[model samples]
Target: MDSSAGHTPEPGSPDEPVVVLGVVAAPGQAIGLARKLVEADLTDHIQTTFPGARWQLELLEAGVVQPPAGDAEIVDATRDLLLEHEWDLVLCLTDLPLHVGKRPVVAHANAVHGVAVLSVPALGATGVRQRARGIITGLVGQLLGADADDLREHQKSPARSALRHRVRQLGTDVDEAGTAFTARVLTGNLRLLTGMVRANRPWRLALGLSRALTGAIAAGVFALVTADIWLLADTFGGIRLTGVALGSIIAITATLIIGADLWERGSSRQTREQVALFNIVTVITVVLGVAAFYAALFVLSAIGALCLVVPQVFGATLDHPAGFTDYLEVAWLTCSLATVGGALGAGLETDEAVRDAAYTQHPAEPI
Candidate 1:
């Protein structure tokens, strides 16, 4: 058995079957969980879908491979990789987007190569197991030329799976499937959704901005207690707080964007169009996130002032009155201080977290 290139010929008997699950560019966590979920009940599911066929499912994580071109290229590349192993059928799951012409496809399989490739973006926000189940079942049914009933049995039955809208194929005899796949993928606009999801992972963003946020909080607290800050707050009003929030958001966002770009430092040069899009989305996400942070800090400062302030010393300069105005002065001072502290925190942020918050296209290269 030459495991160099070309397809692995299938066994003459249908009694025993060899299936390989090849993972490339897939997230480590998702793959681990999905494999456990599928392997637990794979035999039963396979038997139900294919009746009396005995199957052996083997899992392989190939890490990152050189990316291929289009659907046909991916089919060829997947087949080539599987040729080195003894497997009758190979299911390749990749995190990278798979495109057919202008539209991105969820999955594509070649009956000739006995190989299928599924794009992770097609899974949406569903649990890893269910997404994997739907894709694998669909591939098996399509690859083996299953009867309509068998195919129907494996295809995602739940309306929420939304797998129907996502899964599609090319480079096969399924012309209608190819056309429909393109149309559905384009209409669904999964590419944009995938980017948004990638960019909007709040936990990742928070981790990236941990130091900056901490600095801001500490600064806010200090400002709430300091005499100079109170004096400045007395001189200004809501105008001062608004300015502080805007300034802080801008400073933190710029720091993240710059830091991420430096960290990523792609080998390939990005085009103007790519640069524009990246900047636009990065700015938007940062602005939205920082706005929330700033607002929360503002509320915290207000509350802290009410509880911690000795009213007489904190706002003794209101040449007019001493009700909510005093607290407002303290809040304004804290907001400004917090923004400056957050800027300092930006310097303390780790490069990795900044990259996570800023990038959607490429993973951070090892430092």
Candidate 2:
């Protein structure tokens, strides 16, 4: 299949006023956003925002294109695409988190080269499509040489003003990308972390841990029928149960990271930051996946306890009258024990499988 298939420009004479805009996007979230851009018919928005030339938008998938280490490399890649295609301007979208020194880069534009690179993860986790459209529109305007007066005139419109506010300009001394935009400092890092986790799609992690999930279900079912487990659940207080739950989750999350060697190590300052960022995202992804697994186990255990365990026998085992809360307690305890078992079962999985489940694959590296 043609990776670049979508939104072909209309055949026109040489004197036509249409300006071709090529969107080259990394796979996963970035590519999906590119499709959304096309479906949203951003040409009308761009034409309205710029108000001069008719815009023709085309999407190109960056299949197997690894994330470059720096913004300069990103620009170089985009520039190559610009030279190879008929695009008057090229916008490269990547799920990879990009940075300029300590700041998280939202977008970068090189007016001279008529190219721009937007970091999808830097847009945060919520309102991504809307935010991306706004940023992309702004970048297009900048790349097309919209002057300050032109920008001021456009900002008079509420839509253009909002797009302008989404990304605040940052200094470009770090590289020759010409112009760069970053989110606010503290909030930006939090958003980037969340965005990275979202890109990883942690819910899929639950499905990927097939072996561990099987082990968990087995343990939970076994615990459900055991009288001793019932007694322990009844004896344990709420605080103790909560502790057990938290401990089990942490243990499993840590085990997966350690057993899979998902933790990244780096030597240089910048590399260390990148490494830390990747590790944090990895931890969060695994934690969320494990939490989901725990929740499922709890629900299943709750149902099993209610149906399989005789209320009279449970009460006799606990030396008290069993109620709904008692069944819930049993489910809670069972889930924690099952999660511990799942942690052990995770050891059965190959490192590569766990890594694949836990991380999002990028062209240059896995994050």
Q: Using lDDT, give the best candidate's number.
A: 2
Could you tell me the lDDT of residue 78 within candidate 1? 59
Residues 1-367 of candidate 1 have per-residue lDDT tens digits of 0111233233345322223344433456546655775558855665454432344566776533455444555554555555454344567777667653356667765443446677766668767566666567666554443334434543545222222211211111111233453344334433433344343543345445778879988888877877777677777767866776677678877776676543111122211112222344456566666666666777888899899877676435545555787686678668767866887887777665564343322111101
Roughly what TM-score does model 1 have, to 2 decimal places?
Answer: 0.46
The residue-level lDDT of candidate 2 at 196 comes to: 57
TM-score of 2: 0.52
Residue-wise lDDT of candidate 2 within 1-367, one digit each (tens)? 0011233223253432455788999888889888987888577777666543345788899842454455555665675676566456788898776654356668866543456778887778899888888888767765543445546755687344422322111100111111121122223346445555765668778687888888888888888899999988888899999999999999889889999876755443212223344566677789998988889889988998899999888888888899999999999999999999899889888876686577532222100
True lDDT of residue 215, candidate 2 = 82
Q: lDDT for every model? A: 0.54, 0.67
Cα misplacement distance, residue 26 of candidate 2 (Å): 18
* Global Cα lDDT for candidate 1: 0.54
